[model samples]
Target: MVSIGALARLAGTTTRTIRHYHAVGLLPEPSRLSNGYRDYDAHDAAQLLRVRRLVELGLSLPGVTAALGSHPTPGAGVRDALLALDADLAQQAETIGARRRQLADLLAREDLTTSEQVADLLRDLTTAAPGTGPDQLRRERDLLELLETSGGAEGFTGIADRYRAVLADPAAVDRIGAWAARFEALAGVAAADPVVTEVATELRMLGPELFPGPTGSPAEDGGHGETAWAAFLASLTPAQRRCVELAGQGWPTCAP
Candidate 1:
């Protein structure tokens, strides 16, 4: 027989844990000494060691209780509990593996947060239209994301679907690319610059063939659709936004 502190040291646990185990009926109550302190024996040490091992193996207190019955031995109950725990761990591992694979797929995308189908179409378009800068690519992605998430409502007029059909032809991709290059050239130019107004006015020639709809319907709709449209316009440069305002027939816009 030894003191509670010695039993704790031998079992790799604390006196407090041993006391808790006794209180919860996990370990048999220990003998008391003449000094009124608890006296622990080898049986108590062994039980505590088993309890610590089971807890470290992710067993709950109830599981530990079930595993170490009133008359515990090397029995089928212990094996069954371990088997159940193993099955649970295996399922958790599978779930974690699936989540990691999904994360890997998402991280692999250069155009993160853009819908997958739209990104595939954009990839083909970008390939056909070489020499487009990151800014142009990002803006186009933002537009595509907006259109896709909008659920093809009255605002976008299903222009996303129209773009899908048009972009399938390499020739259309080239034309869109060329127009984008010209527009991108005036990136930092003043909104009032003659080039800005000229490009804004000229957008009429390009809008129908490329986007083909009542273009400013989101602003006309007056709701979250309008807010989303404003955010997209706000993302553009001053001259780019000015051109959109000029082209979209009195669409209100902001730039910074």
Candidate 2:
């Protein structure tokens, strides 16, 4: 008979683990010797070795217990369990790979939040807008930055397509100019007006669709649409501001 400590050493496990296995019914409680110490015979040592091997092969304690038997079928069950674990691991690896690819795309455009495609679209819109100037260009840049950082390449790309369509029409420029004028007039009247606030909120909400971000309140930084718009307006010259102000009039609330 081997002492508990001796069995632990032979089985490459702790005495505590052996006791735990006995408590959990994974291992049978050994007979007590005259010295009040538990004694494990060859059968017990072989059972412990089998348990250790099953654990090393990734079988849970419960799984090992359920599958432990004298028949050759137990080996087949262990093999099947290992195969299932491998399949699960493979799935996790694929998911991790996909996430890494997405992160890589985001990192590559670190300098400009918007993708190249979205930036090109903004450039086209700026060029198409009536009275296009340095200020408008600057505004486009600011908007693109916000969209890129907030929505990501896919979202910015979606907005780019929409804006491109809107800008393609000959009459769209005048309409946009009129809308801008109206928005400026309203902005001048009351920055805190309910109507103005509602419009602003709507515009901000639309921004997320055009530029994706994690589902939450807008970032406290300049990622918010209103904040970006304010920056764009600040960058404009008085003449350019007037042009944008005219474009604001095309909005429904600002329309004549």
Candidate 3:
């Protein structure tokens, strides 16, 4: 028989830790001696050592108690806990490794501006529409950026083939470019001008091929109130608004 202090020393832990183990019901306290000093045995020393080892292995005190108190099999609980800990550690290690690799790649590059997905989209667009103006390219990139938020990069991947086909056609690209320029020209003109009607006709014809199908009714847009659609029209100049309104009249219930 030894004193609690002696047992703690043998177990390589503090006397406070040994008392904490006893208080938590992890280890049974030995009886007091004639001198009113707590007497501990070799078993107490061994159990205290075990608890310290478990704590060092990352088990909480409560976890250590649960793993040690249960004796269904020979140290089965401890083995199970260790295995779970190992698995968690492995997953963390893998995540860290992946981040390290990404960091390495970033360091290796000098002129990396956007994400890989955005960069790929820019490359594909350039191939599809050679000699596209900077302003037009920037506008296209902005549209794609919106798609990136509304739909994921995968959504762009799905539509890339179709967009590439349209961009590859010189006539289609020319028409789109012309419409863009026309919108700029119509910014200040009167909505009821003869040219508004003519532009509306062109829009009604082009909307079918480019926009394809009814976008929404005049009263509602995308099941939401016409507020958003109204705002969109309000943003356009009077001539552009008139052209769009005329086009809508020609193809009522259709939107493009």
Candidate 4:
């Protein structure tokens, strides 16, 4: 005979573990003596140790119980459970190995100015629109980076593809470069200036050249794109910002 504490010590586990096994019915609850202490016999110790060893072998509690319930030795049911667990572990190990290889590739990279998807579009823009000044170029990069990094950028998913198509056409790229240069020319001008509307109009007319989809009423993007737009507008001068706002209210179809 032995106390629960003695059985736990023999099993190389804690008293709490023994109680947990009892609660889960993984092992039979021990009988208590008149003094209120749990009593465990040699048979109880053997069963507890079996449960502990099965758990260490990665058998779930229910599997341990099923294995223990089998006559003489663990049955074919337990064997199948163990095989399933082995296959699951093999898949997990492969996933971990693949993740390690991906991490090694990332570590070997020299530059990560932007993600791969955005990098090509930005490179094409730089090459095709060489007349775009450094400041305008920086603004364009910052805006795209902001959108790309934002979780809410889901609403802007097709932007890169649209830009790619436009930049592929030499005339379209020339028109865009002229449009951006004119937009940058409105730094100190007032918001009510006529060129503000003109620039906004130019942007509207350019919409069909990029995205030829049918025009529809402006639809709300559940405030996600709105937040990004507000942040983008913060960097612009009054006329430039108003022009964009005007273009935004109407062009529901255009964004450079």
Candidate 5:
């Protein structure tokens, strides 16, 4: 038999922890001798060692207790539990590795610019549309950085080319310029005017057919294409606007 302090030291645990385990009904309370001191026997030591081993293997107290009561083969349940934990940990590690690889590919040089360009364009669209706020802008920027760094540029470029073609179409250019003017007028009144909303809605509707994928189309992948186009249209200069208008008429407005 050993004193609690001696048992704690031998078991590499604190006396307070042993007391706590007793309080929680995890460990059996020891008998008090005539000398007014508690005495722990070999059985106590073995139980303490088992508890410690279970803890080290990541078993909760409840789980350890259940394993201790039900397991016919000594340490079998604990071993199975540890194996399950190991398998879960391995699966998580593989998922993390896959994400890391994807990030590495996105950040490669050729992919970066196209990703940013697409995101920046989307942000402009959302800003121009109603009920959008700074939170939306921040999210767009975060997504842009992720996609650009994530090697999504090939898909991005294909969408961008389609937008450029749309802008080059003489009829589309005239419509867009007229739409911009109407929007400018509406903005001069109330930024949230019904006309502004109408223009935004029209743009949203046409955007799907024009861009056609996650970077542009609502059908292919929600409103990513529409948002990107809105951003690009928002950033256009007066000269670029004119060029887009002229493109509709089958004429180059000016040199690129």
Candidate 6:
């Protein structure tokens, strides 16, 4: 027989934990000594050790109770409880494995947020126009992300499908590439230069062929369409701005 502190040391647990186990009826309380202090025997220490082992095996206190409460024999109850726990662990492992696979796929693609359809559209655009640079591709992706954020996923899909159709024509693709090159070349030219006017005229001619008519509906925020168009124009060079303005005047339907 030993004091509570001695039993705790022998069982590799704390006196508070032993007291808690006794309060929770997990461990049987030992008899009190002449000094009115609890004296724990070897049986009590063994019981505490078994309770700790059960807890380390992932059994809850209640589960430990059910497993050790078997009067005639504890073997069958412990075996059943362990089998149930093993099944739960297996299910948790499968869930973690599936999540890991998803993370791997996202890492492999490097497009954690973009939808597959949007990714395919970007790839198609790059293939259709060889000179399409990284900046332009990033802008296109940002626009797609904005569309998705603004609750325009369905509408954006329709737009993407239409754009894909427009890019399918080889002539159209070459014409678009040539027009982009011409526009970029005019970046340093005067806004009123003859080349600006010429580019503007060419844009007017190409607009209808390249783009379908607008949806005529307001943007997701009811007026963000106009705001976004204004922002886009603000970002362009003066010559490009002049060309876009002239083209819009010549072909009102071509204005974005």
**Residue 243 deviation, candidate 3, in Å?**
11
Candidate 4 residue-wise lDDT, 1-256, digit = tens? 5888888889999999999998988889878899999999988998888788778989888888777676455566667767878998999999999978766665655425555555666777888887779888778776666656543345345666676778889998888888888988999689998989999888777774342221222254444444555677888998988887677664544333
Tens-place lDDT per residue, model 2, 128-197, is 7746655445555666676555555565566666667767876756655654554444534444345555
Tens digit per residue, CA lDDT, model 5, 135-228: 4444445444433433246765654565556555767655654554554444244443455456555545444434232332356545454454
Top lDDT model: 6
Candidate 1: the clashing residue pairs are: none
Q: What lDDT tens digits, residue by residue, belong to model 6 across residues 66-164?
A: 988864575778888889999999999999999888777777675786766677778788888867966556656765554444435665667677678
Q: What TM-score does each of the candidates earn?
A: 0.56, 0.49, 0.47, 0.57, 0.50, 0.50
What is the descending TM-score order?
A: 4, 1, 6, 5, 2, 3
**Cα lDDT of all candidates, in order?**
0.72, 0.63, 0.66, 0.72, 0.59, 0.74
Please give the range of 10 consecutive residues that has the lowest summed lDDT in model 2: 208-217
Pairwise TM-score winner, candidates 4 and 6: 4
lDDT of 3 by residue, 133-221 (tens): 66556655654554444334554455455566666787887786677666556766887678888877877776634422223453433
Q: Name the candidate, 1 or 6, with the larger lDDT value.
A: 6
Best by TM-score: 4
Clashes of each: 0, 26, 0, 0, 13, 0
Q: For each candidate, C-alpha RMSD in Å?
A: 7.1, 10.0, 8.2, 6.2, 10.6, 8.4
Q: State which candidate, 1 or 3, has the greater lDDT.
A: 1
lDDT for residue 31 in candidate 4, whole number 0-100: 87
RMSD of 1: 7.1
Question: Which runs in model 4 stand beyond 4 Å of their true positions?
Answer: 32-34, 57-73, 110-115, 123-178, 181-196, 208-256
